[model samples]
Target chain A: MQPFTYERPADVAAALAAIGKPGAKFLGGGTNLLDLMKVDAETPQHLVDVSRLPLAQISDEEGGLRIGATVTNSDLAGDPRVRERYPVLSRAVLNGASGQLRNQATTGGNLLQRTRCYYFYDPSMPCNKRVPGSGCSALKGYNRIHAVLGASDACIAVHPSDMAVALAVLDAEVEVQSASGQRRIKIADFHRLPEAAPEKDTILGNGELITAVILPPAPPGGQIYRKVRDRASYDFALVSVAAVVETEGDRIRSARIAMGGVAHKPWRAFEAERRLAGAVLSDDAFAAAGEAAVKGAVGRGHNDFKIPLAARTVARALTDAAAQKKA
Target chain B: MRNTSVTRRGLFGGGAALGATLQSGSALAQSPPPGAGAPPVDVSLKVNGAQHELRLDPRTTLLDALREHLALTGTKKGCDHGQCGACTVLIDGIRKNSCLNLALSCDDLEITTIEGLGREEALHPVQTAFVEHDGFQCGFCTPGQICSAVGMLAELKRGLPSAVTPELAAAAMEVAETEVRERMSGNICRCAAYPNIVAAILDAAGKA
Candidate 1:
């Protein structure tokens, strides 16, 4: 890791001011940033330590919960309200990383975490995400973990976050603070595709600090998050699904779905949700919803298996959610 | 007895020598060389019930601070990344990978490493269980595994759920073998002593 100055600001205003310098980054939890620094992937000259800031609370909002940015993954997952109301989010948080990592990873840091693309981590390799316009090695190189949706010719790296997938389905909103003012971005518009700029992971402007994630009232349904990985634990997802299905007797009243490990961002299956609404709850209906989810999926050579895997994962998650007792 | 004495003296002498090198703040103390970067900063660390005031490069990780400066070698550096849990330590009663944490970021935090866990005569129950179960072969990842298990048991006692927990909304969870395995998945044992390690944790959990 490169030598850097560290500052623990007392407030958000100070944090924003401290990050105004060039090559400065907000250090929250330091799980991903510090790891990338050790490998020389991230070299910041100044680090504003925001982990100790007062942004660690989970407060009850109007009919919902507002999670502070620095809330550790463990705390978020263990929160009683989250487990009872947004069980899908709780499960998605637990399905990621392991006990130690979850304890150190913050909500904002997890959302801003870079792709785990093997090529991105290796400075020796040519990765467009690391250095834009340099070239994308994952396009033709080993890309078993690359994107199958919302991919562009510039890059195919997927957003390596399970929590974001759940948040997408929950219609969460991100509250961010900048030197100028504050703004709330819909979760769907928060993360961007790897169109021409893979280096820019999210729509977060420079020096914009994420303050909180506001989750709306839990949908009236059964929520489930199902992940398929190479291992049963501690591995990144190959394909994961976060689904909320509300059934009216034998028919589905509403449905919301989001997929991970298949796109540059948490791929919200809007089409699939549209198809499932008011449709009869059956295997054939669920299968069609799954098919609709991956309508425009384009799988690279090594990752062609992910397209079908993602579709099946969506179907399975919806099935499980439908079978579960509604909240 | 003579061999044990020699080994103990050698370990202490090596620790003293490393301590001298660190205290001097030579460029050698900063691995990979800072290359005209920020100066050293004062950091107060409370580790294993002892307070130490040290000046360290901002780039130094908690793992390096514990091992190189404080000479706490029990918290091994396996991958020097978060991938391996060899540097697992308890910060504010929560288990975290020390390798991924910046030493400066952990200033004034309560850090408990393996050495702080138990003494030779009065071993922690988890350590005792590991011994009885023969939970290790080469014993490289033992320190991290023990610390992680201790922290994990605390989490379990607090009703923290794991990925394998059948019901997310359950008020409480049982500490089954699957739960232990899933919870301890961060610590990688290259020796493949998982079966014995799982047995040890279960035994410790029962006793706890």
Candidate 2:
């Protein structure tokens, strides 16, 4: 890791000012940033330590919860309100990295973590995400974990966050602070596809610090997050699904779905949700919803299996979610 | 000792003097010069029960700080990345991978490593359980596994849920075999002693 100057700012104003310069990053949890630094993939000259800032609280908003950015993944998952109201988010956080990593990873850092693409980690490899316009080795070389949807010729790296998938279904909003002012970016518009600029993962401007994630009232239904990985535990997902289904008698009243490990961002299945609305809850309808979810999915050679896997995951997640007893 | 200060220059000088007294090559004798890279930053670490003030390169990881600087070698460095749990330590009673944490970021935090768990004569209960169950083979990953188990039990006691927990909204969960396996998935034993490790953890959990 390159040696860098460090500062721990006590307030958000100071933090934003400290990171206003070039080659400066707000260090929340060093789980991803430090790892990237050790491999020379990310080399920031100055670090403004914001992990110790007073943004670790989880407070109840009007009808929802506002989670501070620095809240550790463990705390967020263990929060009673989250587990009771947003079990999908709790399960998604638990389905991520192991106990140790989750204990150190922050809510904001997890959203902004870099892709797990092997090419991105290796400095010698040609990765547009690591260095824009250089080249994308994942396009043709060992593309198993590459994106299968919303991918472009420039890059195919997928976002490796499970929490974001849940957030997408929950309609979470990110509160950010900058030197100029404050703004809120809806979770759907927060992350971006790998169109031409894979280096820019999110729409967050330079030196914008994530303050909190405001979740609206929990969707009125049974929520579930299902992750399929190579291993039973402690592994990244090959494909995952987060689904919220509300049933009225035997018909689906409303549905929201999102998928991970399948696209550059958490792929919100808006079409699938539309197809499921007012449809009779049945295997055939669920299968059709799954098919609608991957309508435009295009897979690279090594990752073609993810297409079918993602469809099945969506169907299974919906089936289980529909069967769950609502609170 | 509390607040024992060790500058980069003085640390190297002390290493040279100690090497000369022993007349042998030492790990510290081969370290890079103080003037090589970035300027050292003052970091105070409260490890085990002692607080030591040392000036370290900002890039130095907490794992290196424990093993190399403070001479607390029980916290082994396996992958140097967060992939392996060999660098696991308790910061404010929560287990974290020390390799992923910078020494400067951990200033003034309470860090508990394996050496702080128990003395040689009186071992921590988790350590004794590992011994009784033969939870390890080569024992390279033992320190991290032990520390992780200690922390895992604390989490379970506080009603933390795991990936396999059937109901997320449950107030509390029973520590079962599957729960132990899922919770300890971070620590990898290359020897494949997972059965014994799981058994020892369950036994310890019963006593915890």
Give the residue spans of candidate 1 off by over 4 A: B1-36
lDDT tens readout by residue for model 1, B118-166: 8999999999999999999999999999999999999999999988898
Q: Please, what are the lDDT tens digits per residue for candidate 2 over residues B53-114? A: 89888888999888878878789889988887988999989999999999999988999999
**Candidate 2 lDDT over residue span A1-327, tens digit each:** 566789899899899989976689989899999999887788888999999999999999979999999999999999999999999999999999999999999999999999999999987788899889999998889999878899999999999999999999999999999999999999999999989998999999998999999999999999999999999999998999999999989999999999999999999999899989999999999998989999899989999999999999999999999998977
Q: Give TM per candidate.
A: 0.94, 0.94
lDDT value, candidate 2, whole model? 0.91
What local lDDT does model 2 show for residue B122?
90
Ten residues in sequence with the least summed lDDT for candidate 2 chain B: B24-33
Q: Each model's RMSD to truth, in Å? A: 4.6, 5.0
lDDT of 1 at B77: 84
**Candidate with the greatest DockQ versus the true structure:** 1
